[model samples]
Structures are given as C-alpha cells and as structure tokens.
Target: MLGDMTASTTPATSARLRTEIPGPASRALQERRAATVAAGVSSVLPVYVTSASGGLLTDADGNTLIDLGSGIAVTNVGHAAPAVVDRVREQAERFAHTCFMVTPYEGYVAVCEALAELTPGDFAKRSALFNSGAEAVENAVKIARVATGRQAVVVFDHAYHGRTNLTMALTARSVPYKHGFGPFAPEVYRVPGSYPYRDGLTGEQAAAAALDRVDKQVGGDSVAAVVIEPIQGEGGFVEPAPGFLPALSRWCSEQGAVFVADEVQTGFCRTGDWFASEHEDVVPDLVATAKGIAGGLPLAAVTGRADLLDAVPPGGLGGTYGGNPIACAAALGAIETLRTRDLAAAARRIGETALPRLRALADETGIIGDVRGRGAMLAAEFVRPGTDEPDPDVTRRVAAACHQAGVVVLTCGTHGNVVRLLPPLVLPDDLLDEGLSVLDRAVRAEAGR
Candidate 1:
C-alpha cells in the first residue's frame, strides 16, 4: 500500500523548493524531451515529476509542489493512493492481460456492475468500457445513432468532449484542439449553452433560446444525441445555470434524442456528487466517464439506458485494452476509497474551504471577473476590471507565478482567461490552504500589475 511504501521517496506534504522552478535536472529532461517529443504536446509545468503522494508532487529537482490540478482531475483519490496501489500490485502478480474480448474476465464485468450501481438513473443501465474519455464519447455517439437511427448530433457552446476526430468536431473550441485537424466528422452541430457569467440569462431563458436555435437550424428530430458537460472542463469550469440541464433533458425526451452527459471531468465524486447531472436532477439517456475513474489508470466507460447500449450489435463495441485487468482492479479499489472515505463529502468540504477564499479574492482583486464552480471543481475567470473582456495575459502571468512558487495550477477557457482548480479529494485542509494562499498571492500580484 502507499502508506507502507518508503517514506524517503515521498516528499513531505508541504511545498519545499530547493532550486528554481525548472532546476538543472528538470531542464536536462526538458532538453531531452524537446529533441524527441512532438512540439504540439505541451505541459502546464515543465518540472518533471519524480513522485507524488496525497496533494503534493515532487519534481526531479527535489522541489515538492502543491498539486492543485490533480493531473487534470484524474487523481481524485490522490496520487499513489493506498487502496489503488495495493490493488494494482496484487492484480499484476496474478496476471496482466489476456484481452477481455478474447478470453473475457471477471474484473471487467464487476466494473460494469459498479458503474451501473453508481451512475445516475434508476432504470436498467448497461456499460461498455474504453481506453480514454474520447473513445467513450465516440462510442456514445455511435450508440445514440444506432439507437435512434439519426445522423445529426448536437453539442453546446464552450463545451469540450475530447480530441478524437468525432469528438474534436463535436468540440466547440477551434484554436489548439480543432485547428488543422479537419475534415472532421460531419452532422455534428453546435448550439448556444448557458453561460451565467457572460450572458446573465436565467436557466429557463437560456434553454428556451438554445431549443429555439435547434428548431430553426437542425430540427430536433434529426439529432441522434445532445452531448454536454454538466460543468464544462477544458472550456473552463463553466457550470450551466440551474434549470438548463433538466430543460434540455426534457427537450431531448420529447424529440426522441438521447441526452448524453459528458461527465468525463466532473464525474466520480469530483463535484460533491456521484455525477454533476444529479445536481440538477437531470437523468441522462447516456453518460461518458473517465479522468477520475480507475485511479489514474487508462479507463473510460459509456454507461446509460440499457436499450440504447443494447441496440449495438454484438462485437460492434469493444477494444483489446478497453478494461485491462490491472486497470479494472485499480477502479475497484478507487471506488472503494471513494465510498469508505466519503470523498463526495470531501469534495464538498474542499469547495466550502476554497470557494469563499476565492470569492474574497475576487472581491479584493477587481480583475477577477467571476468566481464559479461546485465542490472541488472551481475556477476564477480573469478579466479587465469592471468589464467582461477576458484577460488572458493576466491569466498566463498568474499561472506562471504560481508554478514558480511551487504550486501546480492550470488555466483554461475558450479564450484562455480562466484559472481552474481541481485539487485531489484527499488533500489535507492545511495543504489546500497553503495552495490557496499561493494562488491568492499570484492573483493579487497580477491584479496589481
């Protein structure tokens, strides 16, 4: 187990900087990486991690950085969690892989059962595992199309599904994710989504506006699926207005279209609930989950109404490494941790501790245009004082400063002006407070500039 591991390898909980941000060792690795790795593949912080535990990441230079990003919301139970590590080690000792499709396995079926029990919706549900969020999303689209026999798929503004061809086309952002990657999948449409900060429209009003647009443009009957992130992830932690999700779900049911909640980033108790869609009491016809699932192992799933998934022909949906034994074991252990630790409540506690501090920072620094999110999934949108215009320059400077000061922070948004915080659920209150202090100082310094 993680706790039983040697203490010497795991750095102390607090941030400890022994040298500059990207010290000599990290710089050398960066140079080696630059020579081989693709230029397009970038990192938030260039400090190569040597080890991590709880909420701290130790770099090659021996600097222990406070981890607020949680590897982009993947390590919700925290890095090197005891349960997950132990399970993976035990599974590896038993056997690695025989390919689930070829020989089959109990772990895969067990994970599916767990997912069916945990995911929202009271009706009979089934799941198909995949290797990543993008794969799961693409499969969801396939299932919806097969189930509905329709061609058009509708996504929302400021939404991020994934980077695969179909998902990239479904995505709204064009600069980095979608640029130079087209001739993307056809029949994917984009519609207006509620942005409470920018539009100031109530949930009903936003839903009405979006539905009206769909009626005029694609006609709801033609759309097979309507995919959205309950709380947008890469597009920033943009939580839609309160009634928007339920309204959309109702519209989909009325039109015979599948409502897909892309909870890849907001699932698995990251948003103080098993799923963010539950916050609005909206039960989706389909759901895509990854990131926080499987305790940092490569695993994703498309779980939803049994009818929709069952419509797919046998052997139509599967992959060799979809639910590898080790990954399945990790997921079981991670789920156990989530239940025993009550990490959903832990997420709520994180929000209670961080949101007030962030709101206060927004009050103190006029440049912070908006502070919004739920649970540990939170963000502060930076903008020009007294105006809604995004300030990406300030966002970049603040994130860079936080990195130098030994705090791992991530910036996102279609315009790149939002600083998102996704700290691990296992983060101690003291460590969380310290990370927030660094963020507050960084934002203050940037605001002054």
Candidate 2:
C-alpha cells in the first residue's frame, strides 16, 4: 500500500539533493517559523519537510533525504502509509470525535481489544487510551498507585518517560526535559539502570545493585510502580543487560509493586518484537505504549493486567480525546498492517542489516565506544578516542555530515553522544545500506578529524 502511494511523491530508488541540506526555501521557512514557533520546540534538521513517504523526506527545496530517523520512531509503517491514510480518511468522513467518555464508540473498544490481545500477557488484560505517551504514562502511574495503595514511584537512570510534571519527575534527564520545571510530583525515586558499555556488569549484578538501592532508599514495599523502558529511548537507546528486566520484574512482584514497561518508543515493531519486554520474556504488569501504535497519529494506551487497571473506579480513568475516532481508525489500520506485513520480522531483518554494519563501524572507528540496540532501533555511542568519555561534539559533527550528505540521522543519550538510527521497517535494503554507508563515512571523517 505504501509502495503504491509513495512512488509518486518520493524518489523511487535513492536520495536526491537539489540544494544544500536546508536549501533556500527551507531557510526562508525557518526564518518565518522563528517569528511564530515556540523557541523550546527544536528540530534536529534545519530543512523544512514538504512531504514524506516510505523512507524519504522531501523538503521545501525538493531535497530528498534518506530517513534514518523515522520521526523519532513514529513512522515504523512509513509516513503517509496507505493503510493509515485510507482508514483516517474513511473515519474522518464518517466522524472525527464524539468524546469516548460521553458517547462510547466501537473503534475505542476495538483498539482496547487489540491491545489486550497483542500486548505481552496471556492473562486477562485491560487498556485505557490517551492522547499522548505522557498521558498514557501518567495514567499508568495513577493506576499503579491506586491499585497498590502505595505512594512511591521508582524509575531508573538514563530513563525518559515524558514531559508531564509527573513524568518529568520520572524522567532522569534534567537539562531540557526537566530543567527549571520543579517542584515535580512527590514519591518519585531514581535508581541505577544497567548500562553494559559503561558499567560492564552482568545482568544479575546490575539488577542486584538497583534492587539494593531501592530497598535502602525507597523501601521496596512503598513503591507503587517501577517504570522503565525495555530499550531506553531518550536516555541513549540503552538496552538493559539480558537478565536485568526479568530480575527487576521478579523483585517488583515480590514487593507487590507494579512492573511497568514504558514501551512508548520500543513498542509496536520498532525493536523487532511486538513489545521489547517480549525479547526477554518479561510480562510487565503495566505497559505504556505510543509513538508507533497509531501509525504516526496522536494516540497512546496503558495496557496491563486487568486487576490493576480495574482497580480504578468508573470515570476515574479517561480523557476527552483519548480515543478519538479518527486516531482509533488509524490504529486499527496500522495494527493490521503490522500483522499482515509481519513488520516485527521486518524489524529483525533491519537489525540484521544495520547492527553488523554499526558494529563493524565501531570496530573501524575508535570514536564509536559502543554499538547496541534491538532491531531497527539502533544507536552508536560516540566517545573520545582511546577513552570511554562521551564525545558529543564528534557526535554532532557526524550527524551534521550525514545531514549534509542527504541522510537524516539523530543524536541522543544523557551525555548527548549517541547517534541513533530509526529507519522505517519498509525501507529497502539498498536505501538502508546507502544510508549506513553515509553514516560510515561521517563517523570515519569525524574519527580522522
């Protein structure tokens, strides 16, 4: 479906740069945006995108850039996917919003059913939809607190939940996401997360350290929820050590704390699994999902064990635009596309193609301190040569080089030294390889410098 529709708008085979990275048209538009757009909302690339399809984003100056960052892993099915577009159009024509709380709709129930079925749990499950990942996470916290009758919320270092006041307290980073926005929600505790590259500890060891900290600092019984990203997104795409998640889950179960998986970025098919928690065979008590769920639409959900979710009384959990009809329709189509296309397998294939290249690049370039991730959601942590110190400057240079070469990549991590690549699952191998080649050159050039 995407192949047919995107053929006309984007390049059929390769990236085409008619002008510079941010050509004249894009620069002019940026100037206009500076006058009206909020200063806090920043964009990675200077180019103004006119249209995007498949893996290519065409800017105002008509430069087609190969997308290695899928709108922060939002367009896993590809931008303007036919399945999503068609369903959106059909639903919008029928009706857009009726406020699910006021008037229930079939689409919302259908999405909830889909979540119950698809999410990683064999037991009876329930779900509540929200407008964004932040809302989903906030609601998840609410459910956990109410269900457990506890006050403390446990999160980890190098973690990112969302931008809400509660989530900001949950988030580890403070500069941009949490800076100057205090006094945040109370009863939030931060613990150590497994970072294999930096810590070099085995999964069990990492888990023990984290659990020990929680027991001493927060007290295990007081924690309502222990929220974590199966594969951390903003905190540098850090995939916890193999046994770390399971260990934490077991601890949570023992302590009567809800094991919450913030799969907002790692959910859907981004991490080569329906949910990244599945990779470790860990079934969380609650899962916060968004980003890729609705094929780029603004939709999020808190799906989990029915008991925990049902703990909330009627009218206790809902929002006006939580499950808007159009977004629900888009989610249904997107879920269908994922199932029919087996995009999870596609994500695995992407990792098969990307991980090797990235690892090889890490070996070749001393600047790359580590290469780690699952499936298409991969990242390379840049570091100073001969030392493990993060090198954000070099990371910026490498990303800038790739952007100039007509390949779109992104940088992340707490230290701002990780370059992440989130290519669409439908991205052709040739296009992917081409983008990787550009990345290779960029890293190589930066290493030489």
Candidate 3:
C-alpha cells in the first residue's frame, strides 16, 4: 500500500498552493529525513501528500498539487481508482497474503493467463510474477541466460533498469542508482541507445551501430539477451527509432540472443498500447512488466515465449512474496478496468491533446530542445537557448516553479534536464488544461529570470 492509506476518497476539486514549494509539512519531513532517514534514500521535492485521486495530490497541509508525474507513472489508471479499490477491498477481506509459491491461487494464475494473451508475439507465451520492476527485470535476465546458455547480458546507454544488484549492473546511471554500490552483477554490457535527438542516428542506423558494437565487443554469439526499455522511463521519455526495435529483434534472432523488453514503465496502456513493443509490431523473447500492471499495487511480471521461459527448470525463478494473492486480485481488477474503459485508446487521446501543445511550446521556447514520447507517457527535454546542450538547472527551476504554482512536476534524463509529464489518462480536460497552463507559466517565468 505504498501510496494507499494516505489517499483521499474524494478528488480535490480546487488545487491550492500554499507556503511555497516545500511548505511547512514538507519542510518538517525533510528535516526528519535528514536526521532519521538514511542518506541513501532522498527525495527531489519533499512534499508530504495526505491524499490523491484522479490527477491531484493533497498535501498534508491541505494543498492540492496537480500530479503530472502520476507517482512515477504508477497510477496510470489514476490514484485510488474505484475499480482497483474495490478489488483490493474484496481481496483483502477474502485473502491477502498466502504466497503464490507456497499455495497457488486463481488470482495468480488469472493474471499470468491474461499476460500470456496480451503480450506481443502470437506464439505460445508463459509468465512469472515478481514484486517490483527490478525483480521482474532480474528474473527476466535469469530466464534469458538459462534459455540461451550464455552469460553476457547487453543493456543500453542512458538506461535505468532498477536498483537491485543485478539490475544495477544492467542500469547505466552511476550517481544516484549506482554511485556507492559496487561489485555489481558480472557479464553485463552497455551499448549506445538510438537517441535521435543527441546521437543524430536514425532508428535503422542506430540499431546497426549498436549491433556492430555488440559484434565487436560481445561477439553477439556470447550474448544471452539484449534488454531494452521499449520506451525508456528514467532515461528520459525516449522512444526507440521506428526501425530500431525491429532491427534489434532481427539481430537478436540471427545471433541467437534473447530479446527482453523492459516494459515496466511503458506497459498497461501508458504508451497507448498494451505495451510499446506493439507500436513497431516487434515482439521480444521476454517482456518485463510492472508499474501500471496492478492499478497501483506492487506487482511485476515476466511474460515470454513458452519454450524459452520453460527452459528454466522447475522451481528455478521465484520469490517468497512474489505474486501475493492481494496483488494478483488487484492486477485482475486493473486488467478489467483497462479493457472496459479502453484506457489504451484513452492514453492515445491524451497524447493527441498534449503533443500539439508541448510541441507548440517547443517552437515558442528555445529552451525546449525536444518533445518525445508515446501516448500519456510524455516528456519535454529542456536545453540552453538555441543549443541542444541540456540545462538541468533550468529544469529544476521550472519544476520548482510548477510546485509553487500548485503543480507537481518530475524531471528526468541522463543530464537530468527532461521534465517528464505522465498525467493520468482519466484526467478531465479542464484539469489537464489547467495543469498545462501552470507548466506554461512556470517555464515562461523561469526562462524570463
């Protein structure tokens, strides 16, 4: 119940910004954090939220802040969704824990079954459950290595795979996620991502260059899997070039490498489809999903080809708390919600509305170097005026200004200069416009200063 118990049953209609960005309550929390909490754990904006629903977070001090970040895209269905709440209540009342591995349940099986049917690749598929995106990613690598009988795992530059030791090795960042931690998992490799804005490489060219690097470095044959975030979340809302994914898929096939798409942040309609891989019609050997999979519950899953997944011997990949009954129940409810509401289409509609305005902003403001993303998973990367050089300082100023104006914004990128916006698809048009206006004002004001 990460953000649960603190959510308001009713949505905040009037968003109020009081006492600057980190108001009194948030300031107190920050003080407590520095004193009591481990320095290893930190926060960007220490706003203590008391409640959240739809697209607003109510701070402990009664301030309503528009949630553009969607709790790191966790609540794509929106906070405290009625469908998810009902399921959680019913499941908690009936049965909460009772680990899947200890005593399997219908809910667990149903989620996996749903995954098999939903993920890309018409071929037979299978799935395993885990607790977080990192865990799911780790399990995916395990499966890939076991299936291919190879030890080398290829990751991409600017990738943010999780904070676990194995996933840490898989991740590319060094400061926050991998700074002090060392001696990470071995046999992991990194390749250039198809970053059109920076690398000036088309999807096909980028893919070719990456494959060539793999050929020279890991010799493709020695690689077990090449895991990528279909639409990178933490490494900025970067989408692989149109041909990049498919080309990589072809290479993996030729080299006998398992293709793993870490769709933890882009799945469950956040990217306007069941998963972003479907955009290019490319299917990976394995898919790791989490974040939006269970409405807001803590659940992650790995769905892959049946033969490759089955390569793992019986009782090979599992966890004590993986796929708890409560999480499974929540996931079932979430899937039903997505289908009934057609949230994928909803996400596309949101993107349609947001893209034009963000693009217009890019045209008007030289600081906005690029706007990229698919569906509701969108971002605006800020740079110095008339230059592609990322400006993290301006990004922070704009984000803070948004907070002061009653909007919560999240900045992400390799240089920390991208202000990502993952608003809930269920957001009302008026609210969405209002949030956009705040962003506009914040950007304008920050640039003016």
Candidate 4:
C-alpha cells in the first residue's frame, strides 16, 4: 500500500500473483515500452515487477518470482526495507531536494563520515557525493589528475566503468555501452587485469606484465591514477589473484601513482565486507562506491586519503544533486541497518552456503566454465565443453528457463555468458534455496546432461 493511489502502489514486499509472468498487464506494459522507449534500452529478461520483498519480486501479472538478481545488485538490503522506506518517506515529506552544496545537512555529513570510517586505510579521509556510479568514478579520476598533477589515466582490459562518454572510453565492451558513442576523451589507457582464469599469470607476474604495458604504452610517470574494480563486475565477476591488489598498491606507491578502487558493485556488504579491498592487504588511495550505498537510492561517493582528496581546489568536484538530502537520509538508514542487523556477516554466511552448491552444479554441468566471486557477489561463467569459448546460447536458455520457473536472474561478462547471482542477504533461506534449485535444473537442462 502507498499514499499515492495510482502507480507503484502495492504491498511493499508481498508478491501477489494473479497471472503468468508477462500476463496480460505486463505484456501490455512491454508493448508500450517498445513503442515509446528506445530500443537501445533493452532488458536481460522481459519482466515487469510490481513489488518486491526480501527475496521475491511480484510481477505485473501477480506472480511471485524469486529475486536472485537484486535489481542488478542495487537492493543489497532487499526491496523496501523498513529502515530505508522510513528514511525516504520522512525525507520526502520534510524536504526531498535542497541540494547539499546550497543547504548543508546532517545526513550528508553523516554518510561522508561513514565512508571515511568504513573505507580501508587508517589515514584521514574525506568524501564527495555524486548521483551515480559513473559520476563517482569521473570525480575520482578528476581528483587523481588534480592531486597528482598528471594527465594519463590508466584502466584495465575487460573493465566496465559506465555509459558516459568518458567512462565509455574507460569501458572495454563495444556493442551495447559504447556502440554509437564515439570521439571519447583522450589520455585514458588500458592494461591487463590479473585474470587468472584466462591469463594463467601469477599475481606478481600479472602486475609486472601490466606495468610493462604502462612503461611501453602509457608510461608510469605520465599516469595520474590507475583505476580498478576490486572484483571485475561487468567484465566478469573475476577475482584477482591473492597478491594482485597488494602488489599493484605497492607499485602505485613506488611510482607515485594514485590507486583508485571502483567498488561500485562490490561495496556495502555485497561482498561480505564493507570494502572488497579489505580482503587483500591493499588499501586504495581512492575508493568509489555507489550501487548499494543508499539502499537503492541513486547515491554515490568518492572517499580517499585526506591529503589527496584535498588537493582539488574548492568547487573542483561536486554535482547539483550530488548529495541529495533524501539520498543521504536513505544512506544513513542503510548504514544503520547494516550495523544493527549484521548484514555483512549474513552475506558471508550466505556465500559459504551458496558457493558449494554452485560449484557442485558446475561439476555436474561442464557447461559451467568457472564459478568465482566473494560472498553473495557471485557468478557462474558458461563455456562450451572441450574449449574456453563462451556459450552464450546455453546461457540465454538457462536464464530463460529461470524466468519461466519464477526466478529472476541476470547475465554479465565481456561475452555475455556469465550468470550473476545477486540475492539479497536478507532473503529467506527457503526462497534462496528455491532459486538455486531452479538454477540447477536450468543449468542441467541447458547443458543437456
């Protein structure tokens, strides 16, 4: 139920289904979308959700589909959690958008304080807010350039930063994100990421190899910052080798280059930790976070070493709606929820249970090329047997079956052949198990085993 009597008003979380997946209502909505929305705004699954709870999404057709994708990992706390809803409603009532820069608010400072404290590295830190993950990343790069007084910005191959022009340049995939966009910003460079599954290079070897590219391609002295995702999100949920991050951090120190960790998809307890960099000994000089920061609200931030963050002149970094009061309030509530309810530990517990089941399924189905990720930020990459070629056909069929069976799933990877599982930590065990069962059956059938 909602105060508004029209659209988006239903039970906050209960999935009440009266028809099949795209039943009459959803089919109509999709038709409207096709007519009015740009074809470029495609979907992984043709679904229309009416409401969602801990682990279920009620479709427009009134069917309860297990939510294993978490809205592409945005609602890590689950949909419409009481804490977040309360904060959002209160803020919306009092003042939805006063703009942080124009009118200072406690909620903004409180969230910044949380970022300063929760992020890795004990050095004094400060934060700047943004409206999206890409905005945060853009701000981080600007800060690095200003802080180090260098021009070259180095990224890795198979990385996914965003859809904006600059980030499109930062991004590697060409089809969807960068397809009709061109004339990208210059001085951005790409090097190899420590991808053990494909590269088969050790941590030190990988670091050296990438640095060699820097010397030949970008030149370390000319580089302002080296940006990376702790767990390569869109490129494939690839975890770097054990010593990869630490080695790179040391190199950044030696070369006087800023190390920026784009934890946009892996932060805020999504990966069983406040920050994925904490898993390794590496502490990034700057960190960018967004997706799950404000419990589904569009709030993002760049927290970094105080001195580096301070290098920019006043007004060098900020957005009009960067720290909207409502988003800040939601962030405060989200952080509080994580602490009071122990969601990070919950993520670890869920991963501990899920990784085994997924690995077992992978063993049973050779189509599963790899299963890698930390905590609930997990993925299973699909490949044709006897070779490492991506099996996009099988991947699509598996996802289609999961949707037909009343479970929401998502696909990723450079090749669009990875099935990423982003179930909320607050999901009930029964619901979680049900989704996995569906996934198992789908995988078995797709693999034809």
Among all windows of ten consecutive residues in candidate 2, which has the lowest summed lDDT? 1-10
Enumerate clash totals for all models, in the order shown: 0, 0, 0, 4
Cα displacement (angstroms), candidate 2, residue 352, comes to 0.8
lDDT of 2 by residue, 1-449 (tens): 11122335535467777776788999999999999999999999989888889898888887788999988998999888899999999999999999999988899999999999999989999999999999999999999999999999989999999999999999999999988989999999998999999999999999999999999998998999999999999999998888999999999999999999999999999989999999989999999999899998999999999999999999999988999999999999899989999999999999998898899989987889999999899999999989999999999999999998889999999999999999998898889989998899988888787
| Candidate 3, 283-317: lDDT as tens digits | 99999999999878899999989998899998998
TM-scores of the candidates in the order shown:
0.97, 0.97, 0.96, 0.95
Better of 2 and 4 by lDDT: 2
Q: For each candidate, what is the lDDT?
A: 0.93, 0.92, 0.87, 0.86
True-vs-predicted CA distance for residue 305, candidate 1, Å: 0.7
Ranking by lDDT: 1, 2, 3, 4
For the record, the alpha-carbon RMSD of candidate 3 to the native fold, in angstroms, is 3.5
Q: What lDDT does model 3 reach? A: 0.87
Roughly what TM-score does model 4 have, to 2 decimal places?
A: 0.95
